[model samples]
Target: MTKRWHSLQNDRPFRPITLLPVTIAFSSGILMGFAPAPLNFFPLAWVALAPLWVLLFTPSKAKAQGEKNESKRPFFLFSFSFGISFVWGVGYHGLALSWITGLHPLTWLGVPWLASVAIVLFCWGFITVWGAVLVALWAWLMHRLESVGVKGKGEDDAALLSVHASTPWHHLEPLLRSLRRVLLGTALWCGLEWLWSLGPLDWTALAYTQSPGNLAVLHFGQISGATGVTAAIVAVNGLLAEAWMNGQQLAVSRQRSAVSSQQLKTQNSKLKTIALLVSATILFIAVHLLGAVLWLQPIAPSNTTALKVGIIQGNVPTRIKLGSDGIRRAMEGYTNGYLALAAQGVDAVLTPEGALPFLWNEPNKLRSPLYQAVLEKGAVLWLGTFTAQKGGIARSLLTITPNGATTSRYDKIKLVPLGEYIPFQAALGGIINLLSPITENGQPGAFHQQFDTPFGRAIASICYDSAFPEVFRTQAAAGGQFILTASNLDPYSEVLMAQHQAQDIMRAIETDRWAVRATNTGYSSIVDPHGHIEWRSQPRTYQTHAATIFRRETQTLYVRWGDWLTPSLLVLGAITVLFQRRSLRS
Candidate 1:
């Protein structure tokens, strides 16, 4: 163990220059963990590129002497370190919170570590491959800038010769050269993001990092689904790298000129360095301004129905959720809450998942008086419950119309792996303890479904279903102008859990639909069509707020096409990588 630790330590280089890249990468990852809840921002996103810049710019003395290929190893090491530290900090922390909530502590510890390793390896691999491509592109730009011939008469010829001694290649002007690299890099990053969206890890976009604070930048998301924000983040990182490189080159030139013999060489290097910095600053400012304008735009609500909605937050403890007596108590609590909301002149009342507590098919089930009361009050009750179906067991959102009619039912598409249904349960058998005994194991819904309400056509998503974007998008495409997400987050999640869960806000923005999230414990929020939170209940609290939300008939680019831009971008990014490799070979 001691020897293994020593080997691992030795593999990780502790150079001062490497710290910048690691810090930037790790900080960016940590920021992603806090997104879409309450504390979201893009300013700190600048730090995300620190590690990559350091790795690309910092020269290795060993590689310089041609003694060893230190470049390849350092890139991998830097990427791994950055990915591990950042993902572990951000992603694993939530798993720790799960452990404290009494989930098999061993499962929490094991699962989180495994997930962290998988995520870190995947992200690091992406950075390593892409970072190398960027480096080659930068080198090509440098070469082109050096090739730019003389421009201004005899003085231009003299300047060209002097510049060539230090920088070389006079064919490519400095501004044009920088612009080419920036454009290419931005295009590549955007493309990669688009392609990756088709995969299971589609949530890894830079926009997810800002989810916790997306409300502030809601307008920007309407045009682009977090991809636009990612472009800004990458652009900022590139600019920082350009600035740092310039400063380093200038300092080096000054030192060389002080030696007297290399004054001309030093002067030329300084000029090139200044030119690069100026070009980089201009590009950075332009992108920043563009992002600012998009972010500052107002997102107007599209629907004008003005439906009075009520949310029931039954804070039932996990231990009592499935027990016979516990089921009675859970039913009583939800029914009473619904009745109270009905009295408040609410058009519809919402409840968290499994609010019924008991299995819907259970014989001689207690019919609560709240159902009759809802009918009498002329209010629609949207209740999250469980029902037995041909698919085994399904968690469903049942709509009870004002006339006591069981009007519409939408089943949950995405089921929680362990909490709802055990994975590989047939092979594992009794090794896994089920969270509920409603059925042998709860099954996933056939597909996403939308229901026409008095307010408008609305789509329903259960707790775990909100995590998947494609599900919500399908519902929106099927004419769901409004979305209702019912979740019971009390048993396994924390207040901070809402931060991670806010990824649903992106769905609202992506689809241009108003989203109402009613969680069992807390985080009941009204997310407007543009993904902005109009109102939210306090976490871990039993509170209800009646806020009016407007639904939009207009579809966003993402909603209309669904990750089409991302896939195209991915192809273009791949082509850029190929071009970069070819350029490097030349």
Candidate 2:
């Protein structure tokens, strides 16, 4: 009877729950959202993972002393499906991706108002929950690697570092184990992040949360892409976690404390020294600050050239953007802004995506006023329009020369999953059309980007292209002097616009080129090489302002090499996994 009751207790027929980990992990996810723009609580990201770390390392009663299967699993006592990891995912993405709710109206096209809201909420929650699951899985990987590093033989007692007191390995083991934990944590983070960047669901990179606000750490992004910044952040977080775990242990000399051998005394001293070093590194940001000066500083004045670039923000209404008839109003707004900017003697005038409201080839057919007016002013006009491709229309940058001729055309490579191109149109197409009228697909362009402009050789990152670092890096490496991004963020909230601009700032700093944005709705701004905003337009405003932006010929470590650090760390992680497996077997 007692054995049966004990077995049933573990099952918990009434309710099987671990409340603290669930609540804490979920709260940590909410805090993670506040680290990025619109909230801009920049400090939240540093400590956001602390709760989850505690969850991973803390010894629950059931976890510390339990049956073999229960104690042996990663995140002990927390069953995979019933654990706090999934709950954390819910809390994290719910707040971070609240923007999904705005797309609810699209579903009304096929269903009733109430039904649409229900469907939208279901979809939004489902997606956020799914993403949260991925994050939880990643946390499990990190904790497993950490456990394996500490316990030499994983199968034996599930204790951290089971060592004979007199063995020399134990003396040096503490220090090596701590360092290994940090590396393992960092590598696991980068590896999972790399996997996330593979497909249409690649928007939630943790590195973007650090940009434009975390100035001290932003310098690392210059040498490496955003991944470099992420690695540094993860390393610091990992060190802090290690410190929390081993805060009680102190180094003791045999002569001063007890009757230990001299060799053991020296080993303890070495262990203490290592702990202090790790603590100092995490608490101090000196190395990061120095890297900032060496790699982040802008080019000398003599080596740089400046151009007067104008950004046009036309606050087109939501109704106009969703309707075909709004093309006239959109064109009129862009034309007036273009001529006024031309009057300022701007070198080039950039308009947002869909500024012209028609095809580049058919601009004259819509009685297009800007093409001829811009040519008359002798300023290069770069705007977004549909360029006819082999199969369909490509969302591209249409660059007009002084003679009103389309000399350069750079097509958008990365298309938004549902917005630009609907995947598997034959099957998902009919279903998607019922939700939103987006019937056609936008064809993807080739990767090589080189745009010829009168002012200088520039590159155009069509709105969606801003998210992918490789797109802009390729342009910079190919001798792109200036980077211009054109986005048409109509009907989206200020939160969305700021998120997009935050990404632009990182691109500017990474490429060491001033990034000028021209958005149709708002938040058109210029970010310099040092990640400073030169000038910005207010949200939902119709105006054209020109900022003097600098052009650079130099290529940054990130721009030249492109995410080399991630691969290097992956190799390190593979080696750790090998040793960990071997230890587990023994």
Candidate 3:
């Protein structure tokens, strides 16, 4: 059986018609998608990528079989790797981002039902393809590096094809090469994630997969934001992939080798595998140990006092919330909820984004009964309101005191593309009109804006703003005490809310600050500095949740350095690859 398997592998190239690679890649992606909410089967994240890695790191069958079509081999392998990667990406992102379809039934925007469906699908497919393209690029580059000897050769290629295995240093070289490969592959993955997060669509990071589970590993976020956790994940997956590939390659080498040298090769292979396994195990343990240290680190107390805050969920539907009658209903709901919560002796009351559904400086807002109620109850309110900006209106979070004065206002900086504004408006503005009501794109706020509340200085994030860690990190670095994120998730499902909560949890751990989230229609939550969801309100409910969240001023390593680990590793990998190629040529 072993002889037959080895002969089969050595004689023929990998056949795509068999569908093994495609199936494994697609299944792995689907399995990995469950690592985050709402499924949250996070253990899948560790092993799901192993199959893909095995396929990626295995010696290209074309080269192994001495194919005559040398010109077509590179493009064939590149295209094959990219196709498999895109399939995997499709499965993973398609499952993870299925909630995007909740934006359907866009008749509210006067868009035809067919056009609305097309728009939503376009958004979903576009994002999924974008994410998959990144993964494909990473795989292609990783494969290119492997083939060029930057990451070294497979066990069969080194031990069977090459004469270097006869050298005295063969044993040590195999282990060293495996170590370098894992490090380089992991670093490149981390770098890809880091660069992706800087773009407009930054959702669905690998780190968030552990956000819902694996609290121990999730603690690493404090070291380098989400990228730290991503590095750890990719490292483990790469190690597993390497181990699997080595075993397969070793099996093939044993089958084809001469009887006398077989024993020596077998023993040496065992030693190399054992060494690599031991090294991998130690590396994994060290990651968790550092995470434990950071997780258990005590956050120092702040001079500012804790604030008893109230979060109001109005449960208003997206369509109705904009209508005249819906406006009255929402106004009444927020007004009543605020008064009730303030009457309960809460220090301040919070509302979801667009609670008032009107311009901040408009007469409708200035004449709000809530202003009088704030004075009557001596309460401070953080109202998510719209404000006039230079180009258009800004989604803003405003702090209103008992005196009806707007003390501090934080305009949301990260506006949702297409949802808030059209991308490349110069070219596509005339063609895209799904969101016809929004004739002009919403203007984003300045990045350096300060957020001050009656309780203390706070980091204000409005809805989509929470997805970007740099936003919160910048505020935290500037001495912002606590995080306050207000979101309006009326039409979307609880999946989005849960995912948003996960985002806030990671932000909390990264910055070592308490996070308070206020959302319309569900998932109003308060997360502690330790990434614990202390209190979470029910979904699709009109209610008020009050909790005492402390103001924290402690700056974590991630907060101070801001995602430095991955980029550093990436640079190291580049330098190593450059030098290795130089040495090989000389």
Candidate 4:
């Protein structure tokens, strides 16, 4: 009777029957949202996922009951457990991406006040829903794998015998089982993150939560970019989840055991649970310790090459910049800032994206005082301007020599979705107006556009391109000495600027190069190869920063290997899962 009861209890799914678990999960997500920029409560991220992890690691009742039928597995997707997991994702994304609402009062874009509010809300809801849905899918996959793939496989137990045939491996079964679950969970998370990175909206990556803080963990990016830090987070969370699951099981075993042998088994389980908890704590500390070692390692010196670069931040309102009336303010602000920085003896000056309100070949641009100033300063100048191409307009950064000749140009490749160009414009253009100044879709630059500067070769990214590591990694691998990211972040809140700065810091660490950012409204900064911010500008203020930044040709492991860790882990996990199911059928 006791054995039968224990089996039944183990088979029963762990459900969020009460409001407490659901509330805790949601609250945890809210806390995690603060782990990234603006608030930067990074420590919360280390433990915030525990409740969600518990929910995901526990098998749902539907899956526990319907083990034989493949069709029945879909039932778990709609289970209450999925709802709980999704709620956490919503809570996290809602707070983290609150800056999306900064686009309010879009009257400047010819949008009515009420309509603007509705549009912003719709965008927020859509993105939040998409992010939350991904989380739910992650949880569902975890439950399905635990329930169907490896649950009752006898070969799993004997598979380890080749390593320790004579040892009492049965005594360590619980520990091994917990470790296997954690490994699988970590791999699944990394795979999901990789998928997210490929898309246009990738600001919500788990690793970004650690940036501008948690330097120890951020160092892991040097080896595997943001994916490595994400793997570490998922692994730690999985360990804690396993520990919690074991504790609950041990308590249940104590209540049900009656015979001496049963009592002995219960005591062993208790001992194993305690051991697992202790081991998990140790592993967590060890990961951070190793991270600290990596963080403290000496940064390789620049090859005797340094560029005194000046970054100009023009505090022009987005509304005016898009209008014809704001042309004077935009040109004067950049030209004046450039001249001031030039007087301070900067070798080169950089302007934020769209610094010149006119096209690159516009007659007005050549007549402007900015061109004459560039010629007189005899210093290299980089201008963020539009170039008229055969296909359409191209957002480009033009490099001008001391002789006032356009030496090189790098057109933006990763255009902002909906903001720069509307998708399915043929269908949606008539109904939905993006209110963008450009009527036609901006043309993307070639992927391998080489940017040659007076100092040397440099990696250039415009605005949204910084979010994609692959964009910078390829350039860095091609012997690019330094990184420059120019953005026009007008109208967005300072929170967005801070987040943008964090992304650049990660890119710097990943490529082992110094990064300089120039933005229209604030958070222009310089970052070292070690993910340290040397300088940052005040938001919504017209400011210029001139600093000596090094040019580094050193490529990090991530840049060389190119995000191999996450994909490799995903492939391995997939094979293991397939092997498990095949063994079950046999």
Candidate 4 residue 374 C-alpha distance from true site, Å: 0.9
Q: What is the alpha-carbon lDDT for the whole of candidate 4? A: 0.78
Rank the candidate models, highest lDDT first. 3, 4, 2, 1
Clashing pairs in 2: 89-132
Predicted candidate 3 versus true structure: per-residue lDDT over 1-586, tens digit per residue: 5444344334233444236567888999999998997778988887887777776556544434333332247474435556678788898888888888998988887878997898889889988998888788788777566555543333353543253456566556655666677888888888888788778887878889987566667788888888888877777888777776667667766766577666666666667777667766787788789877877877655446678899998888878887998788888898899989987899999999998887878586668887778878877999998889897889999999988889999998888888887778878887766444457488889888889887779999999888788999999999998999999876889899888888888888888888888899878999888888898999988889888888877888888988889879988888767765664454
Decoy 2 TM-score against native: 0.86
In angstroms, what RMSD does candidate 2 have relative to the true structure? 5.4
Instruction: Pick the lDDT winner.
Output: 3
Q: Give a tens-digit lDDT track for model 2, residues 1-586.
A: 3233223234321245545446777898788878888788867777777666645543333432332344375554365433666676677677766766766565424556777677668767766866776777776665555444444333111133344334556555555566676677777777777776655565556777776687656767777888987787667766666555443222222334454554555556455556745664754375467556855554574424878888888777654654565776777788888888888888788888767665667645336777767666778888777777887888888778678777788888888776788888878888887765566688988888688777677867988788788888888888898888989776667877888888888888888888889888778998877778888899888888987877789887888898888889978877877775675455
Best by TM-score: 3
TM-score of 3: 0.92
Return the TM-score for candidate 4, rounded to 2 decimals. Answer: 0.90
Superposition error at 71 for model 1 (Å): 10
Report lDDT (CA) for all predictions: 0.57, 0.70, 0.79, 0.78
Candidate 4 stretches with Cα past 4 Å from truth are 1-18, 59-63, 66-77, 152-168, 300-303, 434-440, 582-586
lDDT for position 90 in model 2: 77
User: 456-543, model 1: which lDDT tens digit per residue?
Assistant: 7887888766656668777777788678888877644553346535677777766777778888777788887545667877666666
Which regions in candidate 3 have their CA more than 4 angstroms from the true location?
Answer: 1-18, 60-78, 151-168, 298-304, 434-440
Tens-place lDDT digits, model 4, residues 211-313: 8788888877878888888888877777887777666655655676398966766676677667767866887787678778877878756548878999998
